[model samples]
Target chain A: MTHEAGIPLGIRFKLLSDTPQDSAAQVVNEVVIGDYRDLDTLREFARGCDVITFDHEHVPTEHLRALEADGIPVRPGPDALVHAQDKGVMRARLDAIGVPCPRHRIVTDPQDVVRFAAEGDGFPVVLKTVRGGYDGKGVWVVESAEEAADPFRAGVPVLAEEKVDYVRELAANVVRSPHGQAVAYPVVESRQVNGVCDTVIAPAPGLDETLALQAEEMALRIAKELGVVGHLAVELFQTRDGRILVNELAMRPHNSGHWTQDGAITSQFANHVRAVLDLPLGDPRPRAEWTVMVNVLGGDYPDMYSAYLHCMARDPQLKIHMYGKDVKPGRKVGHVNTYGDDLDDVLERARHAAGYLRGTITE
Target chain B: MTHEAGIPLGIRFKLLSDTPQDSAAQVVNEVVIGDYRDLDTLREFARGCDVITFDHEHVPTEHLRALEADGIPVRPGPDALVHAQDKGVMRARLDAIGVPCPRHRIVTDPQDVVRFAAEGDGFPVVLKTVRGGYDGKGVWVVESAEEAADPFRAGVPVLAEEKVDYVRELAANVVRSPHGQAVAYPVVESRQVNGVCDTVIAPAPGLDETLALQAEEMALRIAKELGVVGHLAVELFQTRDGRILVNELAMRPHNSGHWTQDGAITSQFANHVRAVLDLPLGDPRPRAEWTVMVNVLGGDYPDMYSAYLHCMARDPQLKIHMYGKDVKPGRKVGHVNTYGDDLDDVLERARHAAGYLRGTITE
Candidate 1:
């Protein structure tokens, strides 16, 4: 998606991929197959590049710091990226900044997990690996100490938190440039199914205007405090009590902001590119009254291309974005975005298109 | 632009470029550097391709026929594409279809050119080579037989057209699928400077409602009549007396429709991809009340990237699309699309960005 956005800006991409068939590698004109963990590979990749950015925050922080020492510019540099890479660092930083967050503490073992949970909400708590976790992986929602043992088995330090009683999930997506220019997209409601983002509604349908502004301001503050460049997606939980707390932070373009591709005047991916290039940001305003995005998770059927005809015929305004990956069950192969005046219609159209593409809806 | 649109559709491109550094080749992943005019090269390039399509109409018609014989699906097939390749053939075909067109005839030489002019609105007649012309090339406006000799020097049949005393030039862009589904975009007024397209205003501001519809219907009819299986841009001369006459036909995505990239529900490039793929067509509705596109022609300044900060800061809603090409005098290196409820604002924003990018505007 960033590559797509970069083209119009005359930005040429030189991607480093683990495999030739990786979704992004399949489309990028210039690609280097290498292990990003190796400092030499990172140095070679950064040689002629004007600036280095990422779609994932998995690159080793030491290697990024090394690249910076070599006078190579890295967006969301080591310091800012470390927070996204380590949840413990993120929680501590957010706490220091007085940002609202769930009660969390670094746990040593199963006993420590129990102690951490009891300090807030008893029995049910969320245990997350401090680093290298994504899309529900390396995270556990445990009912008791016995169930909490799984997270500690990986030998990675675990951060246990009191899982808030949240009514819904929301995301505040913002972009920041090296020069400190920033723009905030409207807060959006992101719905997750089986720990994977399922749908997102821009302007968060019925969200209080004041609260939305607060979320936007908080996200902007987070971006600035972290010295982050490019995109910063603040995953938020709107609690049952009507207060919002930061649930997670992503230093790259997040799934929750995908709807901006068709819904907003300037897409998150486009703005991320602009931010990384240190160019002034574009407008983050939504183009429609309501916009809905639904993920098309891979299912038993691998041929999503065949379903395009039917889905498009049903809703001509449907915007489908496929990742150019071979479909596998539960994999995120693509997503569909729909926008219009009516939220119900937009939601149904997006859902129907996504379902059809996943081969879950025959009609 | 089409390659960018194809990415979200998961369409992998196999480009046949004349050089490795061609603008499209710079972005397309798989490129075969070879002369497209060579039958053997074309055949080799089509070996693994499921379908053959073009960004231009220069490939020999016979070569396309050969590809079709090889079971390769060539969208806007030879028969349909010939109209865009040859002006004389296009004029004859449109006339036979009862479509409104300027009075024209094939001229054998300078004497015939004068005789052809006498048959219409005499001298200062527009003369164009039957084939191979773009961006104001292969065309001439001759005042007399002495000046008409220049066109005959090409050794190709020259098409003599009555230079209509038109109020303005307009373009109606439409897309069609192989399955016969078609959609028409609102008519747009195209402003040309020195025979090169300078600016475009979507829906042709203040145009008569009936005339706009007529123009759209005419474009749709022409697409159907020509069996055009992708985007067809019907260029028209809106006469001083308020009648539209067919000026030209372009089978591929045209410059006039560039505004659709940021202003319409689905861009012409995207719809063209869907049409060529035989997928259901997308909507051609405008997302804004008024959209304006201005071409960024290359000038003495070769660096357009440096102007991004100024242009983007000036108009956050501005959408800049730069082609990956070396800047050369009078060449189209990029374009700016600006849209809003107010036409004048949109026009000014688009023109300003384009001018800045072209280094024609300092502030």
Candidate 2:
């Protein structure tokens, strides 16, 4: 968000949003209420900016190409961004580069889905729409042919893949520059609840040293191969066999790296700006031995600020970041980060603060 | 500034300035072009705010009291703020509370200044206007009767004090909430060049442990005695005789505490906001053993961004905080903060980045 870049570095940020009430629009310097799909609006917004980047990957790629063709610099240009925008493209590209990924194939017929499952572990293959999916949407774990028919109803190209038997989900975040420089953060364990990221622990406690190193190297390689000129987050699956499989790629700052805001020497947001601007990358060293970050989801509490006093008073070391948004049930309203020498203590503090904010815990 | 507070916490900040072109206006949520001297304007501006605070200590105390009387929350109320606004008041109160301060007296006539000089060390006494002075303004080191006439020109009462022969200057910064909770930061050595703060070294390298503890206690005591509702910076003179004399007090975030942005667990700006809002204060612990901060004054270079690539590339750990302002020679445009385990290395990196930004150093 502009809060991360504009404040610390004093960058003049102008946001383009569909409405004035967008969380970022409320905080940035200028807000142009317009649709990103409209080229005229995009041109008008780009006029005042030195470089163009993104918070979401849903922006049309052709529009980005048009802007780049007009001599405007677009970070993580369409070539690299498409891999995140389309699952089919990402799977093919990773396969070509010998990157570990789940067995996948673009399927026009439901029979191909069954065949993929039959060739692999059989049934319960992952079906994805390949485009326009986020936060568990357009994704399904199908066991039988009847359940697989749901994805085909959307009339979009469906990508079927073998669901790996993984110990846990992990994320390796890195930022790259146009100058061929890149820095990788420690691999972290990301816990999900109802397909939404609920908590993340940096350095993935008890993770195999070799696997952690391999995850970081794989992310760095992806940044180089894809020519990603900004933050690249490579979500991975740590299999029971100790092999790492690439699951997803995000070309912007990821939720898994949010702990870096307070725990790392230089935050991922600050590094993202530097990478996109072609400035030197910052040191991705942790300030503490262990850091735990827990997302604060909206619940029955409408006035979030009311809970701040107790949370702050209870844990003075916790760093809470709240997005300026109207609270909605199950929405990610904010996050709490706690870091220290003791992993258990840090985790307890972070989880307690987050739970308190969500009105799930009280004392 | 609001840029640091507003952006990080998603707070809607509206700054009241004399002009729309003020650097803070360029980055804040809104700017109301009005004079702080105009009570009507202040009232109108306060109508939209929950709480009121300031960046400078020059605002009329009477106006602040009036706003508080009207049910608006004025942090560090007029009673506490006046100590920082007037030197005579601060000296009298600190003296009454047995706080260590230079021998001083309020003088109405020029002859009183001459008599005070004779009573003290005889000649070369420090004379300062009791009100409306900052950054070397309204202060004079008078050695003769004729030299004392300059301060009378301001038509304000002057305070004369013994000129302490000190080894160096130190600042102990602390923040307090309305509930009387306070946290003290590590004392830092503040180096002044031409009456302006040039660089600050946190934990004051080679400083005695007892002196550091005494400085922090003094600052905390001052905050408690004054009922300060936000940040209180106690500037002290570290005499050659191993004594600490209170030199000045600031009721807001001071330049001396800027090192906290990158060095400490919680920044002064964040603490100030927390204090004013009556939220619990954050931990004031240092993230590193040593931190060095250097101010960047504008020089011959009109294009400051042109030098950033080199500065960032050279020292990726340097945290640069630039004020969105036009380049004016000798004007404070930005600052750089560097922290590490090595004091010498941290100081070198900070100085190099700041000097390069000011075009004082090349390569």
Candidate 3:
């Protein structure tokens, strides 16, 4: 949602999905229930929209090219979006551009994975599918060659790489317009629990100024080299030795940038809209010294509103953003942002609010 | 317009308007084209809504009381809203509660107005209709009995008040829930041009701390005394001798609080929704040292989007809010907010952005 009133008049959101029950369908101006795989359905949806963008990277790249050929404005185009749609393409492109990444190679056979593992430190190799993987699915850390066969059974090419010894994960979020204008947000530290993002802190507490600048520059260079035109979230691994390596890339708003909604001078969603429309970018300055965001995963509690009294009274400064979805075990239903001068206090407030909403903390 | 997503799912908006072309009707989930004066139509609309609220105060108070009698939730109820709907009632209530106000009286004849004016400093008394006036309409500064005849033509009770010698006007915005939880925002200086609110500066720059506290306390007291729920905007006149006099009151989100959208930790809109819902109130802290909001009146230009490139590029930090109204001469179509450390810089940026949007400034 946008903070500015009357924006709904200029924004005519037409959501295309297989069912009308999609969370996005509730707020959009129109909903087209159809199969994304069908070119005719995709074309029909594109016909009514001035531009076409995506919340997911799984849409067939050829269909995006078809829309572009039909004179429709498709942000990030087929060429720039392919890297996000396919992991193999992204790894190859980043390597060619000399962007630092883990040592890896595509393995067609289980034996090839074993050989690659042996070439580095024996056993415990990171394996991933070339396509259709998200939130740690289709990824595995195999300790032996026998365990590596699970990825090959899927009949897709497997990517094998050395699991770098990293201290933590950082995300460099930047938005680039079609006019080549770009602005980078401060690097943030992202914490993962069970392969899902749990928390993110802006400015990455105690990060070296020189390293922070380097991370921003790296993300900016990647956005320029890929010709990506909207939000680009560059996930990085800051190794124990202080070197940064690219882990993944997303072409749209990512979970790591959620803190910017309540903490920054301008949110990533607003910047994404501006970039897609080719308008001038807004300042990405932080409004406070520290901001902590925690994801609210669906748990024991199904009634989020009932918890509002306790949360609001406990921490009046917290800003909660809920995504309308049926509560389910381990599902992400919402998130909370807490910002202030004290990092520890902000973190505690955000964590407490999120935990309370999830029913993980009764008191 | 809400910052939190998924609010549309829980709150399905059904707008009751006279025409389908009403701008509010376009974004809401449903629309009933019916007259507010028709009891049957109002009853029908009320059947589908969980509660009833208003954007304007013109709806008859008795109809609202009838709805409340039927167990329909009417926020700020008729008793509290009538103070805003009728000038005569508001004046009497303020006087009974010992709230400081201008020397005033309800006059049945033109001679009564003359007597009241003579009892005061004489001549130039402000004459107003007891009900139904907005935006400089139904209000006049009468210099003589001949000038006072204009109010009699309406055939409504006239209110006569001594025109106080004041330094400037200020607005104290506060939100109260049915549960008795209330939060007050920083008092703001509201500037008027041609009797229309033109600009607002948060914290009423250069205001004395004790006086600011007094204004907030007075607004809070008024809200409690009137049993008001939802947002309350208390308009005050700062006398040249360092005292505040109540001028008027509004029971909904007032234009003076628009700067809170970008300048405050919790905006007035969000707080208003929380208050009406009877949920815990949010913090009312200012995000920056100073915030300046300037209304964008319709001027020579009709194409606002064309000016975005210039304004956005020139002031990357400026926040603009449009009302989606077709541009007409002197109409309030939108507003711009600029904030930062320096008051002078913030004021200039806000004025420049608003002037540029109205096509009143070239550079």
Candidate 4:
């Protein structure tokens, strides 16, 4: 949550902790002070920074409102940011904006869900809590009359969506600055597990050129419509018929963007700092023709270092980033990225390394 | 000089410095302790480290001999490293190994200066102090009888070499590990002012294929002959007609190899650490077709930050490395690197930024 009010300048900045090693890659010499909940303190911290940005969007809306009131810069201002902070807000905004979203109904009670399901797609719809859901937590799938009733007692904001049979999922990311200039990275197909991303392939190999353009344009449109001033990641599903349907929106650097750190001409992190600080957007072109990124999950393996060494020894070009974190089951720890002409050669080695890091080591 | 001891692993390896910065980029966690002049203390520090390496070659041979006696690993062991540490040792080894070196005469008294100037190539031969000279500090051009006497009077170990008319100055760097594994980065041409290197263009623009191959081969042969265990940067010159001649040897990371930091797949610094630790040799292949590196000399102008901002704003792709040194007139505080397909684009931008950092601000 403290990541929201991060300095719009500087690279590799992180909060200080006892073990700086196990913490995130610290950006040297960035200014981050004051409280997240207090608007006056946030305003004082935000003043004079060239561009205001976020690592993650969890800042209270009123705090951003206060920053805007005091004539300080805030990216994706409160109106656009609130949608990412609250799922109900996102669902309503997407609907009002005429974007194609999944057929779904919001429900406050078990009776409301039962009635919606009776009239809608009958089974196996995704039930998601409106807030605080990430990496498959705070989300569930319900198939029957008995299952839907259980979580409503906890008093959580819930929504049901028609679980379209997605041929594949894609993430379209575009970075915009306060100057209204935006650039999009190649749309990538993201493979997920239990609603958590596992791998991303840029250019979404064999994806229709028209669809890819649509996805990029849609992401750009969303960035402009929402008045987002930094990087915006739009998660989508390509149904069997190949229509790109909006699934979710992330207004900060996303998991799909990790490849840009090494694979692109300018890294998403560096460009994000440029954008929120209102600097001219850098070239978002890929350095190589293809770049594939894989997530390191703690779900499968206990000791990832053994796999990490093997990967480093095997492929000299594979760029490995292991966030200094205590690995736990199903936690997102780090990622491995590779870029080159031979996508299969790089992807195979990159995928093998990622699988190994995620405890999926096999013969 | 304790850089010869070894680097600690990991960025999070708190270096016990106020700002948590270390001398080497790769080595992170291990504590290294040593005083530059104390022979006995340096031996102890070298003995305790996981590996032995160097940032520069200034350690005395007798001290290295002492460490060798205590079973500490001194990469490019004393026998090989002395070729760089002492000029007499270098001329003898390269001559014995059948490498092309400038015709030279070693001298102690002022008398040898006049005789070599007449007997060798004539009035304009080069005079070099045998030890402890860097960045043109210990080198001088003795055009005639009068100019040659000052070097000998200063008690400097002087050597005279016939001055040759050269077309371009060049460098061929080879990296070798203890496991007998060696990798060579592409040979590069260096631009210098007053014998101080100003810029390096990798692949040595307009270099014929045979010359580049010859440069790489020569550096590799020298590395093998000397049993050099880390990087060996062999400076060279391509004569107007055809042949290439060896200029000098840098036993540590040479200025020319700085291109590898951003231009190559595996940086020379990371590779040097790998070699010293007997780890696998990484891919030393160039990432792009062309690579260029330019040193950021200290500016006459007072404001360093403003200079950095100006250069950064103009070219986002230029990779800037600041050494945390206070800017003084003509001091080397940092460098900027670039790589691209078009030689002109990379070269012009790199030189422009270098000029900006040096406070020249050219059109």
Which candidate number would show the highest TM-score if scored against the true structure?
A: 1
TM-score of chain B of 4: 0.91
Tens digit per residue, CA lDDT, model 1, A127-230: 99999899999889998889988988888889988889999999999999999999999999999999999999998988999889999999999999999999
Considering only the true interface residues, what is the Cα RMSD of candidate 3 after superposition? 3.3
Which residue pairs collide, candidate 3? none
Go through the candidates in order and give each one's DockQ.
0.89, 0.68, 0.46, 0.21
Could you give candidate 4's per-residue lDDT for residues A177-250 as a string of tens digits?
88898999999889997778988888688999999999999999888888888889999999998798998888
Give per-residue lDDT, candidate 3, residue A191.
95
Question: What would the per-residue lDDT of candidate 3 be over residues A282-315, giving only the tens digit for each residue?
Answer: 8988989999989989997677777767888888
As for lDDT, the candidate ahead, 2 or 4, is 2
| Candidate 2 regions with alpha-carbon error over 4 angstroms | B1-3, B6-10
Question: What's model 2's lDDT at B234?
Answer: 94
True contacts kept of each: 0.93, 0.70, 0.40, 0.10
Q: Model 2, chain A: how large is the TM-score?
A: 0.98
TM-score list, all predictions: 0.99, 0.97, 0.96, 0.84
Question: For candidate 2, what is the DockQ-based docking class?
Answer: medium
TM-scores, chain A, per candidate: 0.99, 0.98, 0.96, 0.88
Task: Look at candidate 1 and tell me the lDDT of residue B65.
Answer: 98
lDDT of 2 by residue, A286-345 (tens): 888999999999989788777878888888888888888788888998898999899989
RMSD of each: 1.1, 1.6, 2.2, 4.9
- Cα lDDT of candidate 2 equals 0.88
Clashing pairs in 1: none
lDDT of 1 at B145: 95
